[model samples]
Target: MSNKIKKKKMKKRWKISALVLVIIAIIGVVGYVGLQNFLKWKAPELSGEPKVGEWYRITPEGTKSANGKDWHSLIKVGKENKVIVYFFGGGLAVDEYTAARPLNDDGGFYADYADVDFGVKFGIASNNKENPFKDWTILAIPYSTGDLHAGSGEYEYTDLNGNKQILYHNGYINYTSFMKEAMKYIPNPDTLLIAGFSAGGFGTSLLADDIITQYFPQVNNVTVAVDSSLLLTDTWHDVAENMWQTPKEISDRLVSDNITLDSLTSLSKKYGNKIKILFGSSLRDEALSTYQSYFRNGILSTTNENGDIYEKDLAKMVADLQENIPNVGIYIWNEIEKNKDGKNLTPHTILPSPNFYGKKYSEDKSIADWIVNAVNGNINSYGLDLLDK
Candidate 1:
């Protein structure tokens, strides 16, 4: 071969080799991150005790977030024995069974907290013109571990790329540690309302009864209000039960509650009138429709999953649950006022929402009045506030 030809071939060979190396490196990084993206967490067992009538951030001893930092909750002082616990909602970022995420793929958002001055920024925490629980003490728990902030899990799963990873799913761990210490501050609450929206709402359904039971002796009335988080389906429930370690976390000991990770329908049925449970959701909430998609996971093509169908199904689910479960009331809303997207946020999160006060749901009651009923454990007195689709 000629010298010129040989030289040209050698140069081309080196270039091809470099490109191959670059491709390999990119794949290597993706694989490494995929292996690390397991949706799990463990909260350290909290030691010592909570202070009474004092505000402090309770960091669980051994609990670590997906970002590898300790997670904590902020407590604010309020009236003696009357408190409102609101679980802050953020989207769940992890789906173990190869389901595509609607937004970001990282579970790190589960523990993400913005240290805003809740007393001023949050209307629910402060005395607003229409808030009923303005004077009540507030306990805000931020969602950190992606397991709907509901699982107490230590699990392993094989990702889509065939990489095995371990997940902590330590929401139960975080709650147990926080609640145990919370008792010190809330020794005897005459009325306690546990409320949350979105993923936090789902978490409340799983965890609220635990609080009622823990303070059963002293609490005269305990109510739970779950907002825009009616994400229950048989398809994803089986996966969540196994992969998220959900069984024990959902088993409510407060009442003779027959716990099942299968569907909320039966769970609510068995929970008839045990404690007042109130639910609220928008007819066409975009945010929740995406989360609700998680319930069908692999059954429907993730991309083709019908949002309208899911939204109607969700509304129907809430309506049926209310009829089946006594003391279980619901406030269903629609786009009856000036809303941003018209269809989506007709009313996503009610308690923390600016529309929580006015915006009539019925002729005699506003959203604020319905909430008061929820906190007071009133049931079957309100009808659906559905707007035309």
Candidate 2:
């Protein structure tokens, strides 16, 4: 072979070797960077102070997830002899559950938005902010756990800080654990109010009777306020095919089903005036339809082993209880004006009143006033300035 050819071959071999080394080095750097990120990455935390009208946290309770993640609970102090432990309706992922409404890409709905805030505000104002009731507290638990907040259902919200926690999926049956942990942060046990709206309200009624009765009997006082909860008696499942189809339908079914309050009436009998219930309802509401659809879907039926058509068959449980329980008071808002032009307005969370400042929807003073009266133990007269105050 010629000397020139041999030199050229050696030069080519060197260039190929150098190219291979560069590629290998690049691959190694990329892998190391990827692995480092995988090890260090964490979900963002949601944190903040309670709004002015809202209650602030006094003690933070630590929570451990099934996976062993640690979290803390927040609190809002009330003044009345009653402490309201609030469980918010659906929406958002976590921190925003306590917020008036979750700001979703598709917009939000439900009377619960107004119901929850109004209830809280009423509690604060009824006592004239002096909190005549001692050791009163409000626990606003955000929905950080399920898919219940999707679409317009986004009630729970988490912000930039990884603070607000979620409900453990299997935790409903195990909610006692969360309740037990919550007791640690409470100011007192003698005076406690457990309440919620929509599904939350339903859960509160169920838990108040099942868990509160079996476990926390020392809690001499129990006040339940449910605004359009979707729960009816277990028997209601027989006619609940429409329960999972629409919000308005669901509301009608639940109201008709006779589920949530059926067992509540008996509480007052067992515990006397210690168990007081406040129920707020609207005559015309479509949110119930939305809920009926959500609940009547095949999943809950199959899980509970219920027959078809659950919503219809559900005893007008609330209505039936209303007739029986003298202490279980209810306020029915007969005519709710929805629009400026006088269209038939459905009772919804977002309002048309101008009171809401940072809220995503309009506000209504009538609902707010009613809540104030209910929380203060005044059922008959709700002092509201619908006109010029």
Candidate 3:
């Protein structure tokens, strides 16, 4: 073939290939966006009797997320008589500035809505064979209201654009309503595990008492596990009292800046050996450290200094809890991960991570094993050496 003709033919083929690639890219983008939108607006429907081992998304009436979106929870019917009421974490909105901006992701100020699909295949809520709570019925509460699942009042704030906005801050209401619905399905569980991660970890510490006293009064075998929940701020009492408008019982315990520490301490004193308390966290949780930085420096920073600060605070908090509540079980793991900027960051919560089943600090005990043992009244600490490091 002539050289010019050969070149022209090659050019034409290349153009065709480029055109096809462009078309595929467009379709992929459209499909991805369409899927996201569908998931966001999909209405939940659960028909007939609750089936065992199947997850059902339930949207109880009067449940609203921070952004006024419809809130929902996930429940799975299990063959066992044990029940796990788990609260998922997002972030917190402590003030008007934070309330107006709900980032709906990790390290954000808060989440605007619950992710219905979250926890379907993770940790205690998963169907994984290695999961300790695999057969236990689950009531998974997704965080969205930005009040650590403890607020019941509406908060008004001004947006960055200067527009007035109202945040639901209705976490207390949402969980209570969902619990009522959950009781209808799994009414008489012999063993009840109340647990939460990050923001929800704070919730577990704050609300476990109410849950036990109000709902499962007859179940004596109860355990509470809090994962990676920490926020050092002096305004916690004020925020709990005025902004979140938490129950007096919960707010009154906020005599100190660390809500999780305060609540857990009070709970230990009140419940004593009646309820097993397990607390776990990374030595330098990136998410919690960033939040701590925000509270300390008025900016969200994930610096090595901030991480050191978090570690010091965590060590002190652990020591205080141990001194105040002698039997409290502690689990501290330091799993090195990376942040978006490629900086070294310790992972935040383990209960919802896939590693929950296999990750271990002790040679014979995985976090899951430790949790199972604790739930069975064999409370012991794991990963405590990480704190020394």
Residue 116, model 1, lDDT: 24
lDDT of each: 0.54, 0.38, 0.79
lDDT of 2: 0.38
TM-score computed on alpha carbons, candidate 3: 0.87
Give the candidate number with the greatest TM-score: 3
Pick the lDDT winner. 3
lDDT for residue 82 in candidate 1, whole number 0-100: 83
**How would you encode candidate 1's per-residue C-alpha lDDT over 201-278 as one tens digit per residue?**
777777765666665446657677777775554334544566566655463221221121222444455555556777
Report the C-alpha lDDT of model 3 over 76-155, residue by residue, as the tens digit.
Answer: 88999999989888778887656755672222467676764634555668787888788999888888888989999998
**Where's the lowest-lDDT run of ten residues in candidate 2?**
11-20
Better candidate number, 1 or 3, judged by lDDT: 3
Off by over 4 Å in 1: 1-55, 97-120, 155-166, 247-274, 294-307, 336-347, 380-389
TM-score list, all predictions: 0.69, 0.49, 0.87
lDDT comparison, 1 vs 2, better candidate: 1
- Cα displacement (angstroms), candidate 2, residue 139, comes to 1.6
